[model samples]
Target: MKNIRIVITLMLTLSITISNAGTPKNDKIETPNDSLRLAELNDFWAEVSRTVSEGDFEGYKATYHEDAVVVFTTGENKGSVSIAKALRNWEQDFIDTKSGKTRNSVEFRFSQRVGDETTAHETGIFAFQSNNGTGNDNPKQFVHFNALLIKRAEAWLLVMEYQKSKATEEEWNVLE
Candidate 1:
């Protein structure tokens, strides 16, 4: 009986150790490389915002991957669409902005960001505002969004964009 109990205890201990060895750590400690990569990701998003604000259509297009996909989960247009199709739909807006017919700006605030050296998943709210180059009376439209990006050849390009839903200003303010 004593030998049996010792064997059972040893088996349990070994099993526990093996299980733990395969389990991922819940608490992730940010390393220096992580911080640097995050900074680069921030710069990537800033470039997106800057391109939209300045009506740089070519620059904006460069932010996305060649085979990017966009998932729209709000309103009547709730479906997956190719990035090229979505860009075609928004081409007029870009043209208008570039022609000084409208001024637009987009700002992002993240609630969560997780990623490694080459891939990232960012969840956040984006506030897009547009005016007819008149004044600051344009209402800011906020949307909850999740963006999946991958770094390729020194450039971070969006692979998938999930526009989840419309977000209230209150919800937008809660995230920084």
Candidate 2:
């Protein structure tokens, strides 16, 4: 089962990378709706990313549906942990940095979301750096993100999100 999961993850990473990376002539935004949605999703995601970068856990949590499912493939908190897990993780990470011993940073690249009026799926590349106040600028870890969001009561909320590691930097460079 683990092997299968890894295989599926690899396929998704490859496909998303291919679609977002390089020239991408075949997947251009082809409609007015696409342009509008692209704008909206980008704006909404900007809020989420900002909240994350600032370690605003409550604000970040608000971006997701109450019953959202979030998964981290390369973190210690692995597998189907519900929203509460995120609360815990954020709280702990925040508290861990209380003594001025750490820093958490998030930066996104080449991100885009596409879907219909009530639903959207965003695929992109990002990195979350855990800095221990060292002079080094390298990220301790990073991931490629795939997210699903639903429009509820005219607002968008993430319903499902997945993260994996590697090869997304090139894909991200394709955007900016």
Candidate 3:
């Protein structure tokens, strides 16, 4: 009976080890030239904000990736909008504002790469401009944006963007 118990334990241990060994690791760390990418993406982000602030939809659309998706945090259309339409709609909204003021601009600070050269995930904070406008009705604009960027030939294009404008203490959970 002792021998049978020992054999069962060994079988269970072996099965567990084999199953773990067969599972693939999700970590695909890559040493990307982050400075170059940052420069490029920063330029694009600036262009987007500038175009929107200046009420130039065409200029805003020119900075977007061909298939990029922008998620608007506040305003009428608060969901995902196409690259072209997003520019038009956002420009119109800004123009219709009380003073046509853009108190703060958003920036993208590349965090890290967890995939191949063709694809990578990045994270950054959406900073708020504290100085500008007429009053204190600025919505406390601060958020975090995560993006999945894809390299197409010689250009890097944004494929997906997820944003969380606010998080409560109860939801501070990140499962690895």
Q: Native-vs-model 3 lDDT?
A: 0.57
Q: Cα lDDT for residue 91, model 3?
A: 60
TM for every model, in the order presented, reads 0.84, 0.70, 0.51
Model 3, 40-134: lDDT tens per residue?
Answer: 56565677567545556555455557788877564454688666665555564555442455344443443443445456576655544332556
Q: Candidate 2: which stretches are off by over 4 Å?
A: 1-29, 75-77, 95-101, 134-140
lDDT per residue as tens, model 2, 95-174: 54445456677665656666987789888777667766685655434477788899898788989988765644556667
Root-mean-square deviation of Cα positions for candidate 1 versus the true structure, in angstroms: 4.2
Off by more than 4 A, model 1: 1-27, 133-136
lDDT of 2: 0.73
Q: Which window of 10 residues has the lowest lDDT sum in candidate 2?
A: 92-101
Residue 89 of model 3: what lDDT?
Answer: 51
TM-score quality measure for candidate 2: 0.70
Query: In candidate 2, how many Å is residue 24 off?
Result: 13
- RMSD over all Cα atoms, model 3: 8.1
Question: Number of clashes in model 2?
Answer: 0
